[model samples]
Target: MEDENDCISSDEEDQLDFLLGEEFGEDDDAELYSPPNVDTLSSQDTCSSQSSQSISDPLERHIYWKDDNTEDNGNVDLRTTPFKPTRQPGFQTTNFTRRQLQHLKTPLHFLNLFMTVEFLTTLCIATNHQANYLINTGKYSSYTDNGVWEAVTTDELLRFFGIIIYMSVVKLSALEKYWSTNVLYDHCPVNDVMTKKRFQAILCFIQVTSPGDIDKGQDCLEFK
Candidate 1:
C-alpha cells in the first residue's frame, strides 16, 4: 500500500508541472504576437529629420513653376518670363493740359461774353438818344399821331455816326487787341470794376488747384 501511494503522488506532480508549462508558453506566444508600442522619442526624431530635409532657401517662395513640368530640368529662371506692370483697377492719370480743364476756362471766352453785353447796352442807349432827338425836333413835338415816327433830323443823323464810331472803338478794345484799354478791365470799381475783379479772382483760384500759370491778356488767351 505504501509503494502504490508514492507512485500516485509522483503522477499528480508530473501532471501539475505540464499544466503550468502550457500556461507559461501561451503567455509568451501572446506577448510576441501583439503589436509593438512605438516610443515618443523615436517618432519625434523622424519628424525633425523630415522637416530638415524640406528646408532650403527663403527665396524659393518667389520661384513659381520651378518643377519638373517646366521647360528647364526641375527649375525655372525668372529672367525668361520677366514681370510687366499692369494698369490697376481704379481712376488713372490723364495727360490733359490746363486749357483742357473745364475749371480753367479761357479768359478770352469770358471777355467775349462781357463785350456782347456791353455792346447791347451801348446800342440801346444810342437808339434812345437818336429817337428822342428826332421826336423833339419834329413839327408835332408832342406827337399828334402816336404811331407816326418823325423824319430823321440832323442831330439824329450825327448821333448815328457817333454810335458807329463808338461801336468800332468798342470792337477794337474788347477784342483783347489792346490790354490797357480792355473794356472788361475797368481801372476803377465804379465802372463795374468789382465784377471784373471777381472774375479774375476766380481765375486765380482755379489756377491754384490745377497745375498751370495764370495766362492773362490777349497773348495769354490767344484769341482769333
Candidate 2:
C-alpha cells in the first residue's frame, strides 16, 4: 500500500510538470506572435492629428483642392477669359503723298527715286574727271584709235544703263555681237543709243568716287 501511494504521488507530480511546461510554451508563442506597442494613439486622435497637419500645410491643401481657372498669387487668371481670333490690319502706304504715288507711274520715275538727278550728275563729273586724267597722262592712247574721249553726260549715262539692261535681256556669245554687222544680228537696239566705241569708253572710265578719296588702308565699304 505504501509503494502504491508513492507511485500515485509520482504520477501526479509528472502531470503537474507537464501542465506547467504547456503553460510556459503558450506564453512564449503569445510573446512571439503579438503586435508591437508602437501605435499608442486612439484612431480618433490619429485622424485628428493628420487633419490638423493637412490644414496647416498650404501646399498639401493646394494639391488636394486645386482648380484650373484659379488665380495665382494676386494676378488675374488668364484661363478664365475665352481666346478670340483677331485679324491684324494690313500695311497701308501712308508714307508717300498722292502726288508722289501718281508720279511713280513709270518704271523710270521709280528708278529716279533711288538714283536722283544730283547723284547722276555727281557720277558724270567723277567719270569725266577720270577720263580727262587718263587722256592727259597718255594712258588713253593705248586703248583708243583717235586718243579722244568725249565727256559723258547724265543723258548718255542713262542711255548706257538702258543699253546694258537690253543686252542682259538679249544674251549674246560676246559683247561685240550686240554691235555685230551680220545680217542676222543687225538693227540691234543698243546701236541706236550709242556707238560701240563710245560705250567702251564710258565703261572703261566709269568712276563713282575720285581717286584722291581712295586709301590703301581705308575700308572700301566706307566708299560704298
Candidate 3:
C-alpha cells in the first residue's frame, strides 16, 4: 500500500509541474526584473518615450556581431545567426563620415540632452516648492495626513527613472552604439573621414561654452 501511494504522489507532483510550466512558459524568465513602479517611470521619464519609439522599430535593430553571417565550425548557418540588418551603402556613411557628413550623432542629440536637463531642473524645483508648502502650511503636518502622497510617489519615480537611464547608458557602452531620442551616436577612427579643421572648430566651440559656475550663477535665473 505504501509503494502504491508513493507512485500516486509522484504522479501528482509531475502534474503540478506541468501545469506551472504551461502557465509561466517564458514569463518566469522575463519577470526577473520586476520594475518597482513602471507606471511611475513612464510618467516621469518623458524623454525616454521618444527614445523607446526608435528602439521599437524592427528595421533599426541589428545583430551587431563580428561574425554575423559567416558559418562557424561548419555547424551553424545564416538561419542560426541572430537578426542582422542588411547594410546599405548609406548606412556606412551614417555610421562613419565622408566629406560632408561629420559625426554619426545628429545635432538633435544635443537638443534632447538639453531638454532632459530642463526636465530634471523643473522636477527639482517643483519638489522643493512642494516640500516648503507642506511644511509651512500647518503644525506637524505629514504627507499622509495632508491627503497627498505626491512626495513619496514622485521621489521613487525619479529614482527608478535614473536607474533606467544608467542601464541604457551601460548597455549602449557595451554595444558601442547609441540610439536615443531620434538621434544617433558613432565615431569614425579613420582620418580624413571628414574635414579635420571643421572637427577642430567644433571641439573648440564645445570647450569654450562649458559652464564654470553653478552656485555663483544661482541668481541668474531670478524670479522677478
Best by TM-score: 2
Model 1 vs truth, CA RMSD? 35.2
Q: Candidate 1 versus the native: TM-score?
A: 0.15
Please provide, for model 2 over 1-224, each residue's C-alpha lDDT reduced to its tens digit, 9 standing for 90 to 100: 22542322333334334445544654433211111221221222444445434433432222223355755585533443335657447634577899878787788987787678898898998998888788878876654556666678999999888888888888999989888888888868777778888898888999997666657787777855
Of 1 and 2, which scores higher on lDDT? 2
Best by lDDT: 2
Candidate 1: pairs in clash: none
Residue 92's C-alpha lDDT in candidate 1? Answer: 43
Considering only N, C-alpha and C atoms within 3 Å, which residue pairs clash in candidate 3?
none
Ranking by lDDT: 2, 3, 1
Residue-pair clash count for candidate 3: 0
Clashes of 1: 0
Q: Residues 1-224, candidate 3, lDDT per residue (tens digit)?
A: 22542322333333334435534654443321222333332342345445334433321231122334655474543542456667754334454337445432675443344446556555545544544454456522443334432332333334434434544655645322322223343332212232333222222222111133235756756986
Model 2 C-alpha lDDT versus the unseen true structure: 0.65
Model 3 weakest 10-residue run by lDDT: 201-210
How does each model score on lDDT? 0.37, 0.65, 0.38
